[model samples]
Target: MQVVKQLNPLIFLAPLAMLSLPLGAPNSITQSLALLLLAPIAFIATKSAIKKPIFITILIGTLLVSLFQVALNPNKEYSVYQAIRSALPFYLLCAIVVSYKKILARIIAFEDRTPGSVQKLFDRAVRVFATLSFIQTTTFFLGFSLANALSQSENDRVMIFQTTSIVLVFFYSIIRRNFINIFLTSIVIIGTGSKAIFVATLLLTFFAAYSRPKFSMLLKIVGGTLILGGTLFYFNPLVIERLAEFAINSDGEKFKDATREYEIEQAKETLLENPATTVLGAGFAMQVSHGVPSLDPAWEENSKYDIENGYWGALVKLGFFFTMLFALSIAKGLPRDEFLMAILLVQSVMFMKTSYQLFAYMDGVCMLLWSICMVAINKINANRNSHQSQFQQSIQR
Candidate 1:
């Protein structure tokens, strides 16, 4: 164990964290290979006391959910196998981030500093985070481009990535005051053709700008109004058409009609037909029978759309209880408003379409959430100690 620890410590783990990039590119062999490389790093980095409780709780919860799903699933062999494969890496990554002492210390140091130091540290942190965000987003888009170039398919990767990119852009906008990056990011987000993301990004930007008193009220109002108006006018019809067609039919709609209404109606029926399934859910791999094709269906399928909505998809697979727990985990894990808002926007975008690829994986977003939690926990600990020290001094006096 000592030899293992020495061979695979924080320095070795850094690259694994780096490799957890956002690109949803199709490379099964590469992903497996990367996992092999990260396994040792994961082992070494995940060795801290503070993170142990968090890791244990999440692991236990996940295991319980998986165990229940396996027992209930009619096709247990395949479902259990796939669930473990998909979930274990996320668990390891969470543990690795939590146990990494040096990273934790640095974050605690930054958070416990004076105001001027905090500002400087914040700037440096923002720059680093923004760079990481940029790398992930760029790699994802490039992967999509490469895949499409090879396969001759023009379909975008998914909606959530676009929304995540917008969130990152919003953060960068706050720090750099570089509207060009924001503008470019806005364009890339729009390129995905996700209506929810487009609207969420607009609102996110407006609120972000409004949060600060530096901008005049009038500028904030005007800027916000313009964003709202542009999105409503430009993106509305296309998104409405796409979504409407997606809801009712098993295939995506060819043209815009009242497809969304029909799809919602169908989803309601599906839910009503399976009341028992509602509480505990249909099981992990139940979607294969829900009419969504293994390959992309030409038409919209209601169940297919659910996969795109992270909140609902989890509910359908893991049960209502687990879904609620996971949601709470996300909330507890996010410390800052900006981070929470970013994730919320991504979730909203996810809810608006059929994008399994986007919301399914735990990647950079999970890492960020864990980091935020570490900082929050560290800060709380520091404040408690400070208060205790003051009390002791007063008693001595």
Candidate 2:
């Protein structure tokens, strides 16, 4: 398909989609708005993709999986109509993002466009969100926020994945490495107190360090971080408390205080109960009846403990075949650029923590990652290839 003469409307939605407000702002509103807004973009992108067999073909494989999901029934407890009605939105979200990726890939990879403000703008939007959330968390830790604020702030920490993911990408994508964003997201991660993010951070730092003038600098960086971390630990009692929870207790159990102990067990039972459901999940996006009692009864329909864990969420929802298909699509389609590669690496680590990519919740953040990935892949690879061609011509000359 020919590149559109006009800019993709995603530029306007990109920031809106990524904007998850900080300081206990109503995220349900934002999440709804994000999905609501993307509905048309999904339609538009799909319509555009239809004209081009190549772009549509890329998503046809996965869209079919989402389609077949509408029919597959491993657990008779849920209705067939339930899959079509309930999974409609979920399917739409996945389609929109996948379609956008292919379109953006065409623009970036083959169309010879350079990484432009469209991307930096999305990064900047998330960067601001991450920084505000970081400040929000810091203030909460310092005892400035209301008693009710921490849950959302902690949820904001979940979003640090997006912030941190963006931070890692800019190291190789944007002009003049985004050190400020990197610094902000890193501190937010400390508040995360998540071993997954911590592990990913260490590996990211290792790779970043490896690229430094001397490999020996890794020692100095780690040592300095440890010392600073110790200093921060003393002052940040809340951080100390968060980290302490991860430590083994007198009972010799680790993560005793961890939430989702129930969700973990539920997901395991659901997946292991039947080989049919195990290989093919109970069904796509089946709303759990007892999702969250504290919220509206209607909201409970969205509840499924299975979703809390990314691996199980994807596995229990799409089962093995489609889950791997979705993963391989992301893996195969992404360009060989460090910026995108770093995000994928961190996301790989995040599979243990959340279902951002797998289940398609918090998908605006997922869109940001995918959008950035396509932009980077398209622009970086295209530019690199062009330069290589020019270099070959020069050699021949």
Per-residue alpha-carbon lDDT of model 2 for 218-336, expressed as tens digits? 56556645753675466444555555656775677876634355556667776776786677555653443234454555335545433556676677766676666556645554445
lDDT of each: 0.46, 0.52
Q: Which runs in model 1 stand beyond 4 Å of their true positions?
A: 1-58, 72-81, 89-106, 110-163, 216-289, 294-306, 352-359, 363-397
RMSD of each: 7.9, 5.9
10 residues in a row with least lDDT, candidate 2: 146-155
Candidate 1 worst ten-residue window by lDDT: 144-153
TM-score of each: 0.58, 0.68
lDDT of 2 at 170: 32
Q: Give lDDT tens digits, candidate 1, residues 1-397.
A: 7644332322333343344344444544334545565555455445452355666665676566556655665552434444544465555545544554454444455445422343344434433444444554444455633221101124442333223534554544543465554554544454445555555665666565655546564474457447644764474344444445444444554433343344444344434445555654544433322344435442233333345444445455545655555455555543445444555555565555432322234343333433343344436455768999999999999
Q: Report, for all candidates in order, the number of backbone clashes.
A: 9, 2
